[model samples]
Target: MKKDFLLSSNDQLEKFAGIVNGDHPLKKVTPEEKIKVGVDLGTSSIVLTVLDSKNQIVYGAYEYDHAVQDGIVVNFMESVNILRRLKAKAEKVLGRELTTACGAIPPKTGEKSAKVVANVIEETGMMCTGIEDEPTAAAKFLRLSNGTVVDIGGGTTGISIFQNNKLIHVIDEATGGFHMTLVLGGRYKIKNDEAEKLKRNKEKEQEVYSVIKPVVEKMAAIVQNMGAEINDPVIVVGGATNFTEFTTTFSKVLKRKVYKPLYPQFVTPLGIAMFDE
Candidate 1:
């Protein structure tokens, strides 16, 4: 049997049009016509999204937990168990067995680590169709005309530079949501678990932002360090970058326009599903 592969595009505008207008034609088709799924095994959460033959979002589900730390499958069985539970939930919502999906990892991850992610997905009774870097996946979803993709997930900051919709460079470094949580935890003298919850509270945005400013600044330095390589606006994604003023803050720091898509957190998973097998 032939294997399916994820979609890789160099044209940001084309990618964006397909996602927003749903003109990819795959989305218009039925579930039977749609045989592919996308599973995002993020450090902070694992998300699964399904697109029918016409490429429409038929079902999507996600679970938040530290099963995978720093994009590595720390507890193999625990991660697999989480994937299994999410798979069942997604199957229930789609009303069918979802056996094939694409998964992703960061650009800097080793081949072995990427395979581990693929293996975890397969353990859920689903075929791992394709695997790509997180920022690459986000780029496919955004289809930016020109700029950089900054994916600030729980454990790492992934950066992908693109021009004319084609990826020209890629970089991934450790330092993301986890660092923020650690900072907040230290400042309040609370547990890391409680700090995570407090960080998500809207009322605590100001307080949390103040505490994590240094972390964000470090992220800014990462961007600044890579600025010479990219020329377009910067697009930010991932759960860590979901704070209320994140984009604005990043914009101010970088002195460039930063755009966050609708449901920014789901961007990579959706892009993973769009991979054309």
Candidate 2:
């Protein structure tokens, strides 16, 4: 019950929320300032986040794409293209070239995945200074201490238990947004792209959630199977957790407190950026 991680204050998180517009979520940073960058190549989306020298968020961009699927660079050129576009967008907004960045991959992903991540960052014209497991980067971003950080990414759900600021256990499971898309696609007999649209559309969000519930439950089960003694509140991050209904489903399944920050999708990316300096 005692808090330890360096959390963004409630007010700071409120500023981060802004709102989600899958078409384009871009925030302009104050111009002419040194900044740290974090590039997150997630299974469903690629995010570019920038923080000023003070570690305050400045500019960020998010794009929904399948360049990387399930922690692997399924499409290398697609991954590079997404990162380049996102980087260009952020740089234009901040009016300064982004030169260095940190990135993250799923827990226990092999060396090849790591190289792909680093290479994509380089292809985008930024030096990939550091690469860490997604959960550990989340922990660093959160200054996490004694709790579980569950990153429910697009193709995988990663869980890392941190006790006293040190990671105790980390696991990755292959059940995430893609599975939900499968359910939606099959139920409506639509293509994967259409299902992705339906899944991200706010208008149909509630209606489609019922169909996606099982996928969420499966993710919760994956966490439970980790077998770690998790008594602290679980902090959920990643784009898949962006679903407004997911936290409730996770809480009920885990029978423990669940928390999501203002912009769950940006957490890991922002955390990865924070680790840059």
Candidate 3:
């Protein structure tokens, strides 16, 4: 799927982008009196984020856990427990109650997991006010009126095609971080846990990318199979694409501008906070 392509030659990626790695930038800023939080029970990790009235980051936290796979919760109690911890931390940091929150599900995985996602957030001591598709939630911050938002999760790569800020098509396929971990596990004959850790280590990234290149290719192919012209810049988020070179490979495959934010992993969870109601 590797092919050369030039840059977008447009301001799409930069003009409509959201916060890039708010961990430091959002700190020390005055938070709104009222705050809204979002919980993303991702397949590889559970993330809790807080946004103020103006939709700025007030607090954010996440923990790694394979409680979910391809967006379906496998260990409901474990997920609940993680969210509980995250909520406590956010509340402590923000010095306020976080009683209600919003959450999201991967594309096509919603029918079976949307209620579960909302329930997980609720069980963690907060009222689940809304449950939205992952890509839709991300769109709240991306504000890209036209383009594709590709959510590369732990176990699935979700594609959402939008035209004029409204969703026109969506797809979720089994391919993502988990696949990369699997490849690393097999290559090193190590446990899945060890592979996951190694995959995230800066020292091992170069070696790991060589092994996970195929998995990245699968993600690019997933986007390609969507059967659209897909010429606009593709905005990628999620932990899987956090690997430095995933977009380089994806851009070559699609022969189009593929943009990944500085903190791709936080994009969706933070965006989820925008829908708080």
Candidate 4:
């Protein structure tokens, strides 16, 4: 992908981050305008994204959560409740109800995983428009037709290869941000929750990255082991890629350049919204 193309996507993600941070006000949705919605049920958080008919972001919200583990919903009702609250929050901000939403799961999790995700979306009182794999959605949001998309969520690092805009191969591994938290907790002799907070602290990021670098290397090794003809513009997205050194560490291990977008966490959610039809 061209650098300017990725820059444009990052610009959109930057705007979405501002809206999520309350730095940018939410855009209003007229009554007749069709609003597309997306719900991302991640291991550490559940994100709700609203997009205009033309795929422009309008609103986005998320809540830290543990209702999901890996790509599966471990606590169905909790997932429903979080999504419902997010839907209510978006509706209040946009002054219109979200009628339909698309959701996503880690690749190859099977039809059951998709059903659970869609169920959660419907439980929020919005029609479930569709269920897509996470990397596919991330690729869509990045406008990537060809390249590799590695979606690192809280509980898993999913590697996907796309050719001609179609997903040709995908695999999800059981290692991600939560593993980093566990490593930090073990090293600092703190509980997982405290370690999670410490891992996200910008001031402590250097130390945290040092402790977690091995785990990231393992994730990259998974990609390398896949033995696929890894394509250029290898993009990494999702919440687990938040560390500034993440891509560099990953690239070192994989022996290839890696790309990442601003607010890496919101990529899948924003892309899921584009699937709402």
Candidate 5:
């Protein structure tokens, strides 16, 4: 079965904005001829988000795959090919060419790796305006104020410590959805392909979580150890934390406030859009 592309509606986006921005009089920007786009090139998936000038979500879509690994563009042409398809589909839905977009990378990426991400966007015929770290991107989407942002993507966990709404420290480590997949695969005696499917199966959630609990706990410990002044609430984003019980599990282990947006996976993409000028 094909995955559902539209995870949340405009109404949900509004609610998400309210949560992140707090109760302020929101000024709606009239839809213009052109829309801004944000793309998240994740380890396990690629996400595209379109927003009006007012920063309202107009249309968005995401596709899942294991094409890229650990924030590295292992299959450069393949990644570009996937983005081309995604951009085409999104243009069809929005009735416009997504000629410009902002993209992101994991924290502490080398200049070459960062350029690779920009090149992928350029290959899609979209001019890349800005490229930022995944955690910084999440903080922008969440409109965070003086808090740590933890982005757990498919192959790595990125942590950013913020104070006074400024990034103070950034760190990345190999620990994420792929780790969960490994645990689930070993426990169920299934191959990685089958394990991925089971991970998304609502009916198998209980069984899947049981096997991945230890790994998630270990991830929480990693966050706690890395973040010294992260006593403030931690905002969790990225596809890895999409598990139903993820927040509860992490919260229990960390013993602190953990917040997740409505569609956690799209946080980085939305943040990328926010960075667009």
Candidate 6:
């Protein structure tokens, strides 16, 4: 793909992040307009995204919760409740009912994980339209036809390699933002919640990152060990890739330039919305 295409995709991600961040108002849509909804039951949070028929951003919201662990729904009812609240909130903002939606899970997590994700979506009263692998969903939003997608999510780092738009090799490992939090907690002697908060604090990011850098390096090692040919445009997405030195550190280990779109955290959630049809 052209470099310009990636630049534009980053622009789209920026716009979507702005909407999710409340920097932009909810998009106005006609009653006849069709909307797509995506439910992302992430380890750190559950995100709900809405897009128009043209795939333009409409609204997005997220709430932090431990309803899921390592891309699986460990607390089914809690996951359902969080998604239910997000749906209600979206409906109130969009002034219409969301009857259908899609979701995603980590690659190779199997049909059981997909079923649970579908169940969570259904329990929220929305028809589960589809379930996709997290890296593929991120790749879709990034418009990557031939490249690598490294999704460093809250609970796992998923790697997907594509050739001619076909996903050829994929892997998922249990080293992600949660692991970083644990590392930070160990180094700071803080609780998990406090470590998580500290990990995200802008002022403390450098300190937190220094403590968690090894974890990031380990995540890169996971990718390097995948044994598949890493292609160009190796894009990193998901909430775990939020740190300033994330891609830089990952690239150093992998010995390749990695691209990260704006608001990497929201990439998968927004991409999940693309499968809502």
RMSD of each: 7.1, 3.1, 4.8, 1.1, 6.7, 1.3
The C-alpha TM-scores of every prediction are: 0.87, 0.89, 0.88, 0.97, 0.87, 0.97
Better of 4 and 6 by lDDT: 4
lDDT, candidate 3, 1-277, per-residue tens: 1122212212222221322233253444443476778889998899887777877566676888879987889999999999888888766766667888999999888566888888888887789888888987776776667778899889888888888877888888988899899999999999999999999998888999999999898789878877565637588888888778888999898877788765677778877888887
Q: What local lDDT does model 5 show for residue 55?
A: 74
Model 4 stretches astray by more than 4 angstroms: none
lDDT of 4 by residue, 1-277 (tens): 4556688888999999999999997777788999899999999999999999999889998999989887789999999999889888887878788899999999888999999999898887889989999999999999888889999999888888988988888888888899999999999999999998998899988988999999988988988887657777789998989989998988898887888999999999999999999
Q: Return the candidate ranking by lDDT, descending.
A: 4, 6, 2, 3, 5, 1
| Local accuracy of candidate 1 as per-residue lDDT tens digits, 129-199 | 87888888887765565778898888889999988878889888988898899999999999989999998
lDDT, candidates in the order shown: 0.77, 0.80, 0.79, 0.90, 0.78, 0.89
Better of 1 and 4 by lDDT: 4
Q: In candidate 6, what are the lDDT values of residues 1-277, reduced to their tens digit?
A: 4556577778777878788778877678887998999889999999999999988889999999998888888999999998888899888888899999999999999999999999999987899999999999998888789999999988899999999999988989988899999998899899999999998899998888889999999999988886558877788998888888998998899988888888898888988999998
Ranked by TM-score, the better of candidates 2 and 3 is: 2
Q: Which scores better on lDDT, 5 or 6?
A: 6
- The model with the greatest lDDT is 4
The pairs that clash in candidate 2 are none
Ranking by TM-score: 4, 6, 2, 3, 5, 1
Off by over 4 Å in 3: 1-32, 229-231
Kindly report the root-mean-square deviation of model 6 from the true structure over all alpha carbons.
Answer: 1.3
Off by over 4 Å in 6: 1-5
Model 3, position 174, has a per-residue lDDT of: 86
Prediction 3 global C-alpha lDDT: 0.79
